[model samples]
Every structure is written in C-alpha cells, then in structure tokens.
Target: MREHPNVIAVQDALDAAGAHTADDAPSLVVILDEGAHTAAAAAEALCIEVGQIANSLIFDADGEPLLVLTSGAHRVDTAKVAAALGITKLRRATPEFVRTHTGQAIGGVAPLGHPKPVRTLVDTALAGFRDVWAAGGVPQAVFPITYAELVRVTDGTPTDVA
Candidate 1:
C-alpha cells in the first residue's frame, strides 16, 4: 500500500504548526506500519512500552470537541474528566464525530492537526516519558514528540485526565 494522503496532510500540519522546523523538530520519527492502528499495535511495532504511546482520544462535550491525549496504558474515566472540565457530561465520540471535529479518523488523530483547536487535555502520565509517539493523521503513521513539545504544538494543557 502507498502512503495515505492524510499522512501527508499531517506532515503539512506539523510543518505549519512549527513541529517541522529543522531546529524545533522534536526528533519525531514517523513510521508507517500496516498493523499499527491501535496503541498496542503501535507499541509492538515500535518495540516500546504501551505507556509511552500517546493515544489521541476524542470526546464530545455537548457538541463541543474535547481532545484528550492520554497514555495508552490508561483508560480515561469520563466522569473525572467531565468534572475536571466542570461539564455536566462527557461521552466517547463516534468515528464520524471524531472526523468532523478533528478532520482525522479514530486511532489516527494527530495531536496538533485538527481543523481548530479543540479544548485539549494532555494526560499527566504522558509526562513520564521523555519522548512519546502519537498518530500522524493516519492509522499507519506516527511521529515522535516530547511531552512539553506536544503540549506546545497542540496548545494543550497538562492535566490528570487518566
């Protein structure tokens, strides 16, 4: 199979987000793996612990896009996250909803390539890794980024979302 167009879009977004500048580039290694559609698959492909993979989960908060970049080893408790956001509810977004908001499919949402800045929350657990990997707008692609750099590129706030 060839590289998906969405992957190219992600590279462009990364460049536009200043994630691709030669000096500021955070050693993000975008790997293409046919089997890497989930965090487990990606970890296996990269030979890294699942916890080191940052899973970009999308949630809908009364129609608003809520992007939560959480650790692959942890499942986010929606109740706690909703309370953190002081919202009445939080639900997992459907694939279509996720695409509508982030312009990327589930399992392949890039941390910084959404059509707009969704209210983003970065899991505190991600800070444990000096380097982390996240999807690059396609299921078969991923890139390396640091916790601080991810936060900066996504305009996300670090919080205990896990």
Candidate 2:
C-alpha cells in the first residue's frame, strides 16, 4: 500500500506506543469524501452510525494539549470536563495549536503515540461500543480499538464528554 508521510508518522507512533502488532497492523482507508472532517461525516462515509465515530478533540489547558476522544453523537461538555479534571478553565484549541501539540492535524489526530502524551480523556459513551475507530495520523487512515483498549493505550481517564 502507498504510504503518506503522515501515515508513516502514525505508524512510528503506534510502534513506539507498542499498540497493535505488525501482524495486526490496522487498516487505514481513505474515503472519497474529504468532507469527512467531522465524526458524522466520517460515519456516513464509512456507512456507520455517528456514534461509532470517535472525534479527537483538542483542548487548550493553560497552553497544554488536552485530548478528548468523544463519540460523535454527543457534544463534549467542556465545563464538566474541566470540572472533572480539576482545571479552572479549558478552551478549544486552534488548528496551529493542535498541530503544534499533536503533530497531527485536527481531523486526523490519533489517541496515542503523540510526540508527548497529551493529557487524554476518553468518553464514557464509547464504552457502549465493543469496537471504536480513531484517525491513524492521517485524515484518510483509521484503525479499530476497543473502549478498554482505548483507555489502556492512551492511559486516559474515563469521563462523560457529553
């Protein structure tokens, strides 16, 4: 398969994180819809429900990157999240801020293997699914992960994102 630079970077990060094995490398499918920028769009392209799509939202917490993997069907309640995290405030990150911290673009951020571990939160709603998919470092690439594995891989705390 052809490899994009971003995809390569994702592979490197996955390797570093000791995620899935080479024998079980996740498939990254590039869909025709570039508009798959949102979870609802992605789910439509993949023929899945919006809830099945995981939105890798970035929050700016005192200039630090805070990652939230939320289900598409719900909106993240930032105030609640901040309260849960014991942070006084949380703001949506800008595109530049996202790339600076995640080394991946907004529509294609993955859960783990960032240059540094962004303080992460996995949506409790995701636990409803047996499997979940995340961006594989590129907009077109994605991989499957279970809710349990998502927490294990990201070392993220479980909380209500919506």
Candidate 3:
C-alpha cells in the first residue's frame, strides 16, 4: 500500500508540510479493508460521523482548477463559492480535468501532492470536527488531519462553502 506512487506522494507531501491530527499526532494514511468511494461510505467504514469526512472536490473555476475540501454532510453551493472567489463561473470539473490538475482520480484526490498547487478552499464547516478524514490518494486509502492542519498543508483559504 505504501508503494503506491499516489500514496507516496500524499505521504511525502504530508510529511513535508508537517501536518498533524487534532491529537497532535503525525498524520498517517491508512488503507481501509473496503473501498470508500463517498463520504457516507467512508464514515460507515470508519464508524465516524459523516461530517468528519472531508470530501476533496475538484471544480472548474473559469477554466482553472479549484479544490474544495468540503464537509460530507453538506453540498457545496457553487453559486456562493463562485461569488466568494469573484469568478463568473464555477462548476464540477470533468474526470480528465480532475486527473490532469490533481494527478489523482476523482474519488481519491487528496488535498495536496498535486503536480502543481491548485487553488484550494477549506470549508469552515470542517472546523467543527476534532479530526477530519481525507482521501489518501486512493478510494480505499484515507488519512486523519485537523482542520487547521488541512488549511496549513494545502495553503487553503477557510471559506463558508456550504
């Protein structure tokens, strides 16, 4: 599991950024026995609140890649996000665009470790959780991180995305 390139990249990026969980432990990625293709599934697998799963959503914002780390409990209000970013358009990115910008597939995209840094927004709603779980470069892989750590590691702006 550690040998996977995407997992390696995510781990390296987490290490390089000095990310940590709410308990002050180093953030470590773990591969689940079952694949977690959605936040509800991830929450079910981990036995945690669905709101604790940070859904890494990629979007096309006026032709640029935008990453939104939103709480699984709520849907992203694209209109509000577009207004917040002062962009005329903001929509879900295609699978190709997601891969091209994030270097990982849609269901497994992590907040960091992209070929380049995509503009990111961390939902302020995520701050409600003590520890948030994000994809670790694959559908069955995930990692625990604090909201502050997520924002710091991704250099993401905290926004009310829901």
How many backbone clashes does every candidate have?
0, 0, 0
Residue range 12-72, candidate 2, lDDT tens digits: 6555555642245543334344546778777877777788777889999877889999998
TM-scores of the models, in the given order?
Answer: 0.90, 0.85, 0.98
Off by over 4 Å in 2: 15-35
C-alpha local distance difference test of each model: 0.81, 0.76, 0.94
- RMSD values, in order shown: 2.4, 3.0, 0.7
Q: Cα lDDT of model 3 overall?
A: 0.94
lDDT for 96 in candidate 1 is 96
lDDT of 3 by residue, 1-162 (tens): 667899999999999998999889999999999889999999999999999999999999999999999999999999999997899989999999999999999899999989999999999999999999999998888999999999999999999998
List model 1 lDDT by residue over 4-86, tens digit each.
66677667666666663224554453757484878899999988999989999999997888989999998999999899788
Candidate 2 C-alpha RMSD relative to the actual structure:
3.0
Q: Which regions of candidate 1 fall more than 4 Å away from where they truly are?
A: 1-3, 20-29
